[model samples]
Target: MQIRCNQVVCLFALVTALAFLSAACSGEAGSLAAFLTPEGRQPEPTQTLAPTLEGEPAAPAAGTAQAALQAAVEALQGTPTEETVAAAGGRFPATPTAPLLTEGPSVTVTPGSGRANAWVTVTGSGFPANVRVDVYLAGLVSASALAAAPRSYATTFTDRDGNYSMSFAMPSTWPDGTPIETGTLAVLVATEDFGFRANTSFDFVAETATPTQVPPATLTLTPNPTATPVPTAMPTAPRPTAIPPPAVNPYAEVTPLSGGRNAQVTLRGGGFPGHSVIHVYLGTFDAQVGGGERVRYGSAVTESNGNFTISFTLPATWPDGTPVAPGRLLILVATEDLSRQASAVFDYVVPTPTPALNPYAEVQPPSGSANTQVTIRGGGFPANTRVHLYLAGLVSVSAAEAAPTSYASTTTDSAGNYSLTFVMPRTWPDGEAIESGTLALLVATEDFRVRANATFDFVAPTPTAVSGQSWQGSYYANPDLRGDPVLVRADAEIHFYWGTGSPDPALPNDEFSVRWQRSLWFESGLYRFTVEVDDGVRLFVDGNLLLESWRRGERRVLSLDYPMQAGQHTVQLDYFEHAGDALIILNWHRLSDLAPPPTGTPGAPGLLFSNHPWNNQRGVNQTFCSGFESECNYAGCVRNYRLVWGPYCREGDYPYIRPGLYRVTFYGIGRVRAGATDYGSSRQLFSFGQHEFELPGSFTFCWPGRQSDGYGFETIAQSTGVYAAIDWITVEYLGEQCR
Candidate 1:
């Protein structure tokens, strides 16, 4: 089989050699067909050979047979085959290598441009020397190339380094059948050696041209260019001119001098740095100019700065009088050019020969109370002014007659300011609720005729009920009066509610109630009580009479403490009016011993008392047992009796006591026997003591009655030892004892 292969190879070479010779000689393109023919001729049709064992077909190995067949076919067709070579030689074909594909700087094309050029540099590696590159146009190339044609260029060898660059100009002309548009131009680089090929595209566009036109230029020249000639009209030199100065203003103001005899006039508002003069005018009434009477005073000239002032004295013998009527003084200032003018009229009134007095005064209380110290302050009076304050109505000097109404008075000071203050009387027979009244003040001065008679309103205070008491409990009967009675009845109680009923945990214990009550026959005429009860309450006097109660369903009272007296009283209390009930009561007696005792005999128990000889003795010996006691006796028991001072005492001076279960009694006698002598007397017996006193925190008292003349009674024997401090007292009724 080896020998046969060698013979076949030799035969193939001979045939190929013959075909090439034949083609060269014939010089005909058709003669090259001989190379494509099979190599050996066939035997006669009759000489058939039997199949040999070696010739029988075995299953072809995978890949080996196909690869062998491909190689055989390429060799027969004279196509180039890939091969590995150790070195390069002159026999190697010179093929153009593929260029490195990359982007370049972008070029912008205007809409009307017919062509655009992109300088794409082609670089190659592993390329043969002096290679001829055939550039083929990729059909899907950019519109720039489609509207143009494919272009070609040649490049030289890159020496031993095997690198070269060539630039090609892509034409803007398109192939005959291709349309002009925007597209990509794909390029392929290839060579005969099959060693170089690159597939890539570049972007470009094709655009149409716009229409435009340009105008031609023209020229002109002077007729004679040789000699310079003078023109007929020469520019006239501008004549030098001067500007006039601005106009000046003319106006004046006239003011009266100290005594009105001379007038000072001032000129204002004139244009400076200009020659201008002001003219004075005195004209009569002119109907043609305008209606109205006219009188002129005088005018003056202005300075360069446009200001001038002058003093003009009026004629001593003018029309009206020595001082002149406050009219007919008219002044006018007019410019010399008569372009502007200003006028002023002055009317001066002389001061009166005698001054009048101002009528005004104010009454102020020193301590701001009904029994307040009042001060009368005023002005507009001459020196030695005497002012008298009287009751709103009556005018009298004696305290007895003026006791109902009287005020302090004082002489005016140098500055005419006067002030007088005095103790305000307690009673006002004209009525405490006075609306308006008069205060007479007499003024004596040489030139000023001033009389003092001031009428003013005696503003009364508005009454307000205090806390802790109900509507009918202790309240201000007359709030306007400084000493207005704070009337409170026994068994009467007041209720107060506090705090909002908000459902907040933080304010859980906020709501509370307060109660106020008055005691029956309480020592002090006025009584009050307070409690921290949060509901409605009903107050009862004498344990039965309903003095006061809260009808509202809300908790109105929060906390209060008031005064009380010595009587039967009951308080039905509730807290949070709608929640729980609570109450307090104020009970007191006006004539109780709770009042301050009067200053007198060490052990006496009445407001007023007398001390005389025990035996009615004119001397230590020879004494009458019972007779009119010496009015001048200094030390000796005469007789002591009890009397009622009043219904109640002032509440302000006493301390408040709590109420619980208490035992009370009166201990005093109206008549007394001393040293075998019986004497009848009038005295006051008053006393108070705490029994099981139980009260909540925060309580106080308010009592009624005058503070000055209130007293209480105490036993002389029991109270004599240590300045008469009584813990308890007893009262005994004397039926017809001395009477």
Candidate 2:
């Protein structure tokens, strides 16, 4: 029986194994067999006959069955067979449909075992309608195996569009190890038959704060659907308004207070309205009252018209002990306004006592001769102050003063302006000529302590004359000598002539040869004589020749002792010349003799006497030499010979004097002796005589004249003369007796 049972078991095993193999092959062979058969065989019956095993090939035996089962599992495990997998679905080893979950859509948990609940929705494409999906807790899987099962929650239903969505929650029984922080919750989707899987993960975060009993402050977050809210509170105090002060007056005047008092200021301007204040200051000290230990005292208010007056009193104990002394005072005024303030300054002074009288004085008309007018002007004393003008080097005073004395006195006016004009005394001698001295005026008051003085220079004047005169022309009776008539006798007669010849061309012809004569009674003594003549002149005193200066325009002096017999003793002057102006003057005075008489028989009176009587006659005679004649040869001109020669003889001969008598026996004579060899061939030649004389006391003498070319002795050849001659013989006195 046991053998029979083992044989049954063995047979059942054989049958089951063969049915599995047949079923596996049946899927491949059914389509092939349908193609080979008549195509009328039904495929369902052939597939049913392929595999039949008891209870679907129950668990296999230990060794061999286990081996066979493993082979079958291996064949099913690695990759699905193409026929079976195709028969089951479409492909083998089914590809995953993504965005699937293999784990749960569980509640999130925190560290304190707190639970978090969420709802999930899933979407996919190319997934089956009734596909089974596995959901898992990603926390449940090891970190190393997370890629194998990435989905934490998943669902299987494809709602209307082949997409599946499911609600998930964290399990309450989960170990409190995996924190519910911000991470992905993976959801996997897979198929059961071919072991294909698909998955997706979504982010989740856990709350950082615990639940609180007190209500949170409310905060409203905007624009995000997931933002949380918070809360806060309110505030406290009041608002303030600004207040402006009064406007200042730019043109205000400050009045300084005296006697250590603060200044009072008045304001005048336009833009000040409403409530205002004013402040006063003294120097730099602003906060003092009327006495010591004081406080700020000047603040005040203004009226509506924008005008205010503020007064501040000073402290008795000042910082500088009363600044209003003599010339020193300073005060300052200021206005009190938060926006604008104005300031002004004031000063004051004190008086002093009068002084004593001043002492000073000055002088005028500094320096001049004595008797000069001097003036004195001064000041600085009482009215009617006595001013005494004094001389520095003289003794003159206001009355009968002596030499070197003071001279004048006066008084000052009410205005202290004084002036005095007085003549400097002539009798008051002040030093010498060109010497300097001072004329002082002294000023003094009644007290005599107030005294002053001033001094100036003094000088003298020069001298004068008695009687004098000057003369221009000759000393004779001519008008050129009288010269407009100085002091002279009334009947004085002056005589003048044109001289011997015609008037000189250089002189006026109206009075020539006219014998201009004037006579006067004479008083005689010494005289200054001047004579002007062209050729010669002789002057006589009492018919005695006194002086003869024969040259032209000569002057001399002489003293005559006239007898004073009263009647006129003739004073004659003889003048002779060819052609030129002639004049003579006789002047006399009774002067005492200041010199002695000359010695020896008085020298011959300066006069000339002529022996030729033809001198004064005008007509010409052949026997005489006329004044106009120029002689060439003498005796040949006949009995009384006078010959006139022409321009050539006048060019050669000049005049010489013999002073006294002369004679010419023959006018022209010459000689050539016979039988002399040199004379035998010679012609007759003319010669003239030659002689000279020196008289003793007798004045008469002769001169022998000669021509230019004449022999010693010869006969007269013709009657024509050589030049001119004068020949006469007489006896005359040649000494002082002639006068």
Candidate 3:
């Protein structure tokens, strides 16, 4: 019986296998048949069966391979299980199926063909969730526009389902550079992060094409059946309203706070009106419609979320071409309506400054007499340039340039330093003598901007008095000098200040007298004799009293000019002190050589009235027997013009004469009253002679000539009949007048 069962199984397997083979030959359930075949059993290759002039075998009945495999399995189930089938010589294997394919991001446009400026709707799916998806027109009609940066016309954000929809007009021309005509326009959509991307194309046709004839848009993914096709019109979706931004304040910030010109900076802003045009500028704000000095750097359209980021380069100048200075500046961002604004602060960097050059000069010896060689050293000038030098007083540059004292020019070395020498000049270029003890500046200059100066002190030589010109001094114990001198010595100069001390052990400080005598050889010049003493003092040049103050008085100075020939002359001075400080100073110096007047010219007579010698004041004249013979003028007896001792004659009332040295001459014989009390009280009667008197201001004097008649001389009131012929009295200026 088992044999019989195996036989039945074998018979059914054979028939079932034949059916599987026929199905496999028809390419139906071939994989299942192959799996059901026993292992290690090879199927014989099948031969093509020629048609019996009958139609080719009908195609296998239409059915799923799985369903056909299941029917085949049912047929084999009647035969045996897998193990049983294995025991009965049968095997089957299982294989895995691949996961189902999923579509990536894709985009499409309605109406495959469109005219320029025609609106089109865009649809997309399978992009990142809640991500910005930019839509751009690709395959520009113009080949040249293809190489430029991609420009987006429409933008949208994907929902959680990765779907988006937006509409925009077909660009009439390539937005960047060239024009678009009849050609294909590709639509590309991409996630902002580029994680997913898809593209499709549409036909861009001229306006001549009818909208009804346009074909449907080609898509990168399966087309949506629900999308309606326009027959006679290109229906554009309603333009999306601007997304209202959230109630948040607008704010902006930059990457770097400070930068120089041409520096690249990145800017970020938020909380702006959605889909609004935002402009960026650098300047202050103004209420005027034309705006202030604001310059636009760039513009941007905010996303639906009201946020944006942009990058730009800093400009070097303002809109008005003014250079941007260093300071804190504002970066202004505002909406198109200027209703919203945000600002960021930036610092314009300042450049480092260059150092300045200053030139200076110095001399070796800053002071000397004329013809002194001076070396000037300087630096900080332009290298290898010429430097002009000048010696100038406290004067302006132009004045110094016009009259420079010994200028020199030299070229500086490579180090912008120089050294040179110049002799100090006695006179300037204008022939003006450089006086003694003058201070001047030595100026060095390379150009108007480069100059330096050094001081040069010009001093003239001064004469010195030596011991070879000493005074023989004699000191007495009594002011009257009744006794011999108590001390005798040689004083280099007649200068002493005993104060409260005695001059010598034998002489007392007060009620003492001193005498100084010297024979000096003068140099044919007008000499000034200066005497300063306390109490009483007197000066005599060759026995002629030149200056006298022979009375107790305060220490005072008296000066007079004496004209002396180039020969030895006796100079004597006597001083007496009664009390208090004892002081005496006597000295003489040559003023200048005498320059007498020519024969017939009004010399520099400081004070001269008339030429007639007798028109002077002939005051209170008296006439008597006159023995002295001389020219006499109008007097008591105009016929003889003789004057006696009794109120003889008064000198003319001179006009207001300035203070100066003057010489009075008497041409008549007889003792003449030659003293002037207006000058000083050191008056005395003297014989006819010429004497110099240093008159003080407002001087008045009277001169009476007493003739030495051979009659009994008596007092002035009891006229002794002394007659003197008076001549014209003349006054000559002998020294510089003090105005």
Best by lDDT: 3
Q: Each prediction's TM-score against the native?
A: 0.23, 0.19, 0.22
lDDT of 2 by residue, 609-720 (tens): 2232222111111111112122222223543232311101111111212122232222223211111001112242212222222211112223222224421111112222
- Across residues 267-333, which tens digit of lDDT does each residue of candidate 1 receive? 3434322344565443211001112222234445567666655555543333323224333333445
* Alpha-carbon runs more than 4 Å astray in model 1: 1-244, 247-265, 272-295, 302-307, 311-332, 342-739
* Preferred candidate (TM-score higher): 1 or 2: 1
What residue pairs clash in candidate 3, if any at all? 617-652
Off by over 4 Å in 2: 1-251, 255-279, 284-301, 309-330, 334-341, 347-354, 358-739
Worst 10 residues of 3 by lDDT: 621-630
Native-structure RMSD, model 2: 54.2
Candidate 3 — what's its lDDT?
0.53
Better of 2 and 3 by lDDT: 3
Kindly report which residue stretches of model 3 are placed more than 4 angstroms away from their true locations once superposed: 1-469, 597-702, 706-739
Please, what are the lDDT tens digits per residue for candidate 3 over residues 1-739?
2232334445545554554455556654332224333541343211111112223222232332333444335444553445433322223222122111123444557765688778888875656678898775644212211222345688888776677788888876665434465654446566654345555555777456446777779868976679676678768633222111123445677878788889888889776778989977654211011222334687898989789887888877655455556654446666754455555656667574433668888887989876566678888887778888776665332235443444668888877888877656656565566766546555455444688887777786353332347887867778986444556678988788888788876567689998888877777876766677787887777776555556786666555555667987888888899999988887777767764622322224433321122222211111101111111222223332223121111122122232344444444433333323222111322222223222111222332222233111111101113443344443444444433
